[model samples]
Target: MSLALDLAPSASVEVRNVDLAYTRKARGTAPLSRFAVQADGAALASVPDEMEVRSSHLVRFSPTGKPATLQTYSVETLRKVEISTSGDTFIGSTDDDLYVFKDNKKSRFLSDRRANYTDIALSESGSRFGTVFCDMLAAHHTVALGDQTGRTLWTKDLPFAASAVAVSRDGSVIAVGGEDGDLWLLDNARNTVLKHRQEAAMEAVAVAGTNRVVFASGGGAGVINAEGQLLWFTEIVGETVALGTDSVARTVAVLARTDTNAGRLILLSGENGLPVWEIDYEDSRPTGLSVSANGEFVGVSLRDGTVCVYKLFYGDRLAAADGEAVLAEARAARSGDGSLLQAVALLQARLGSVPSDFRACDLLKETLTDAKEQALALSANAEEIGDFLSA
Candidate 1:
């Protein structure tokens, strides 16, 4: 006897595989000391030169996984090491010193009285950097901004302890999130712009563009505008481990752990905190997460002493098909129908992955111009405008 099985439509939908572009093993068993992505999409990682000593060596890897430069540091522990887009490096260490390494020279910039710096953030241009200091003895935390030369620009004391800090790409805004659920947005002049209270202690914080800030806490993650308004919040299944953002693309990548201790990466829109996609990894625990400047790639460092890079546009094959369908629907509809505008947006999103679509770009430009003209005409008509406003 033979049996027949029925399958759902979703089963027939092609499942695109995400490419594990590259993997590099850490130097020793201690895992990666720290890792950051450069502005040009290169990755920098630090690993112990020796298994028993506190000394470490920093390694630079190209986007294609080729090892580039390697530098040795005598510092004991490099807590928060960040590299600017321009190849400048800023690092805070257990020795209570902040150092700036540029042009093959290392200079000690600031000596903190605190135990160690909890986090460090660098501006896109590497002109400015910010750090969060954890002074356990004084029972207070401080957020300090500094220039490229490692000179302290300004410092702000917080009532609660902060572990996460971030500066906007333009170096115009600074954000600090504390363990006591305090969130502060400050201007470059050290003036407070907005302050809010979060439900849980913050684990990560990032600035997206000029007006949006994203943060992850024990409860989950959320996004806020520059005006201090809560845009949206999403609850995760477990601990929020790390957060990374692409300011240019307005995309946020979050690393969290499931209840079973599996690692998962979630991508969200920076504007609305809406979920875009997610990937799960059961074999390794994520220690660090970073997205490229253009949001085209994501790199994850695992506790097993391996770094993995994945492409963001691997699912574009499916998206292009959906875009074609939307365009067909728009063409079949009436000229003034809203489907045309929807088609334009769909095409725009697909263009992120398929930038060579000249036909779609031309159609989008024309549709946007038509929509703008229609809007202007409606506003010029008094009766039509009044009716639209009332509705």
Candidate 2:
């Protein structure tokens, strides 16, 4: 069988001659004869999933916007819950078998009757994987894959059936959105729920950068900080079906589904949850929409098998530069350099006296602690500043 996908205006991705028998071919052997991909009429590499090609062949675009390797898995069909990145791949068969693919080699992660994996997600660095599975009573269990051994390093019990799982780019937290309309945050080290919110019928959830998580809920949408404080919310005419954030632009993108229109995409000012732009798709339904952390690219896939990739241009150099300056200042302050202490002090003072119109205001507390630690160390009064930060 073959499938051709129009991914962009002038570009297309195709896979062809995929085998129907799901068998594990020998490593370093002939690449699966059943699969192939072509981009813009140029032949792209294709690697079919083990034997029967029961799994979907993922054509992941790297962080740099270039097409990377193709990932395939062993299962009954594309429905076998698999996700991959440039570096790693996770696959779960319908029969509750779990497997991991790395460096073109495949191995079983779990092979027990209790190993029913429901959802799998990879961190941005592709260094870790998170999976949600079910026990005898259909309860949910989550497992975290260690980068070095491909083994389950952390596991925890969940309260509800998990629909989606995501790991932060920095691997500090794992967020789970479940069927019970609740979102749970798990600290990766202890595998414990750090926060939970049960108010919204959440369809999707994602962690943006290091500080916040955004979710698409039935009421509209929500943004919550690391402390689980509801940072912002926006009213919507439809159910928010998808949510994504771009760290570069400090913005969130939401896709809503309504009774009348197929769907619409809304861009919100991340700092305050204000709607900035909206685009509606009157005819086609979006199968998936992904946004880069930097907000540089937004990729939307339609049910008709077409994907649209949009590059957002801030187009405002002054404001864009100003945001970048603040981020740089924060980084410098944390580096224990006296030169940045004055700049940090200026930013903190600006935060104290100014109204809360900017995201910088919320960032001031961290800036003060980071800057003071650096300055006090040089003054011989450095007691680690833990009390100050905690207070």
> Which is the leading candidate under lDDT?
1
Residue 385, model 1: Cα distance from true site in angstroms: 71
lDDT of 1 by residue, 1-391 (tens): 1111221112112112245667777654232222266545567776676554856666776766567556666665665567655455545444366777655566776653544677777776778888887565747678889888778898888888887888887788888998877889898999988987777788888876656677887567777776776766767666877888776435677888874547898776444454556778798777778777766667887777777777654332344356577566555542655565676677677566554344556677877887788788877897777889999
- How many residue pairs clash (N, CA or C atoms closer than 3 angstroms) in each of the candidate models, in the order given? 0, 11
State the C-alpha lDDT per candidate.
0.67, 0.53
lDDT of 2: 0.53
**Model 1, TM vs. native:** 0.69
For candidate 1, give the lDDT. Answer: 0.67
Can you tell me which runs of candidate 1 are displaced by over 4 Å?
A: 1-18, 28-35, 38-41, 50-55, 112-116, 134-136, 259-261, 314-391
